[model samples]
Each structure stands twice: as structure tokens, then as C-alpha cells.
Target: MASLPPSDEATLTHVQSVLQTRTLSSPIYAFILTPLRITHASRGLIIARLVLAAPHLNASGSLHGGVSATLVDWAGGCAISTWDLRTGTGVSVDINISYLGGAKLGEEIEIEGRADKVGGSLAFTSVGIWKVEDGGRGSAVAVGRHTKFVRGSASKKVEDAVKTAE
Candidate 1:
């Protein structure tokens, strides 16, 4: 299996620590029940695990569509962060989700996010959520694409300065 380099691993660890210790600023994440266990992290990619629970379910006792969208938003940001290890991942410009299947309570799901392109002013990402069965990834729960406006992010500014200097 592919693994994160030491530096990226440290970044992932720090992010996980922040999630565990801090009261999440995003109310949606708190409502969804936070602290997603990051299974893997590397440049432009992140994989995390979340267990479906009461808050994550709809009245019919399946994973909520809103929750799936929220995961797309959240995971996309994490993938963007991997580009430069920036805490601020930027603001969502657009998000599109396709509900492919359902996951039940007590079921574990894996969310994979990929930063398809990270430019100075914008970042594009895709997220896939799947139910885990028999210790492997099972049916797809949802797939989404997220776009973010990242102009003036700290890392971008620094990079811009370096380019100017060069």
C-alpha cells in the first residue's frame, strides 16, 4: 500500500490532532460528529474513515444526502491542504454530488478526496465515498466534485513572492 512521506504524515497527524482537540468552527462538521480517522495522506490526496451513526442517517435509516455532501466539502478541503500544508483550504465556489448508494447505521465508510488541480487562484477536487465491507471497499455511496476559490491564501502569496523574486 502507498504511504505518506514523513513530512506529509506529520502534517496529517497535526490536522487530526487539531480536530480532536478543538471545537470545530464549522457547525456542520460538529453536527455530523467529527474527528474522521485519516487512513492515508499524500500530496493532493486524502483517505479517511467515518462510521455511520444517528446524526449521519436520514429518517429512513440510511446515510443522509446532506451528510454525503458535507463529506465532499470537508474531504475536498483536506486534499487541498495537502498541496502546501496550509490550514486554510479556501472557500467553496461550487459543489456537485451524485448519490450512488446507501449506507446503514454501524457501517463504516471510506472517503477519498483528490485535489485534481491546485492553482494560485483556485483549486479543484473530487471526492468518493464508499461503504466498507469485509475489510475492503464496497459499494459506492456517493461521488462529488468541489471547486474552491483560493486566491490570497498564505501559501499562494508566498509562492507568488518566490516567483517574483526568481
Candidate 2:
């Protein structure tokens, strides 16, 4: 994962609040409060309910594949962290992305991700991306799955507690 800047870490609380309003923040039982904002957050979750901004645009005017990939990775990472086995910290072991279509500049693309399973030292997550206007149109622009190794920063048992509490 790319090291997030300070701005990203500072926005975590706000992002968590936003995720709370929409059912988008929680991927299963893991809370995705923020990506960059959470800094060293154990886990995070978010929804792509709208199109990206101009800064994230490509020359073709459509969203760039890099941007899409980054989005998937970010969401996928959050899913893994939320259900992290040992600590909130985890590292990606694998991420495979398949692109099928293009997204218009202003199209609201909805992306969702969650852990398929969290193991003793690894977590598996999958993210689905598609246009939101018609629910699901054309083919999927991209689909990605991330495998990560869990750390002991926060204790794997905490994840279990959170799950049980939910």
C-alpha cells in the first residue's frame, strides 16, 4: 500500500461519519471509516456512489485504469483490515485485476469490497466495480481480489470481538 499523506489520515473521522450514513461504510461487520484519513487504521470501508473528479480523469476523458485499480486496492485493503486476524495492520500478498469496459467521465461508479475469509495470517478480499446509473450496465470495468497477511498491531482477537459484538 502506498503511504498515505497526513491529510488522508486526518480525514478519517469525517469519512467514517459519511460511511455511517450510507450502508457503504461497513463491509460485512468491518468498519471502513476512512482510507488515508485513518492513517494506521486497522481497517476501513467505502462506496463509490459517484464518478471520480476531474483530477482523477484520464486523457481519454474516462476514468483511468490506474485510478480504478487504486480504488479497488484501497477498498480491498479496507475489507482485509476490518477483519484482520491479529492486528489492524496487514499487508497485501496478491491483487489481481481484470478490466472489461470503460467508464464515462461523470458516470457514478459503485464499487464494493469485502473479505471472502480471514485466516490465521492472511485475509482474502474481493471488489466489484460497475456503472451505477442503470444499476449494472455493459461488462464489469474491473474486478479485483486482494490477499494479505495480518499483523499483531491490534490483536486478531479484537476483530473477533467486533464481529461478535455486531
Highest lDDT against the true fold, candidate: 1
Worst 10 residues of 1 by lDDT: 153-162
Model 2 stretches astray by more than 4 angstroms: 1-47, 84-89, 135-139, 154-166
Taking the tens digit of each residue's C-alpha lDDT, what string does model 2 give over 100-146? 77777566666766567777777778887777656543356788888
Q: At residue 118, what lDDT does model 1 achieve?
A: 91
Each prediction's whole-model lDDT (CA): 0.80, 0.56
Winner by TM-score? 1
Lowest-sum lDDT 10-residue window in model 2: 29-38
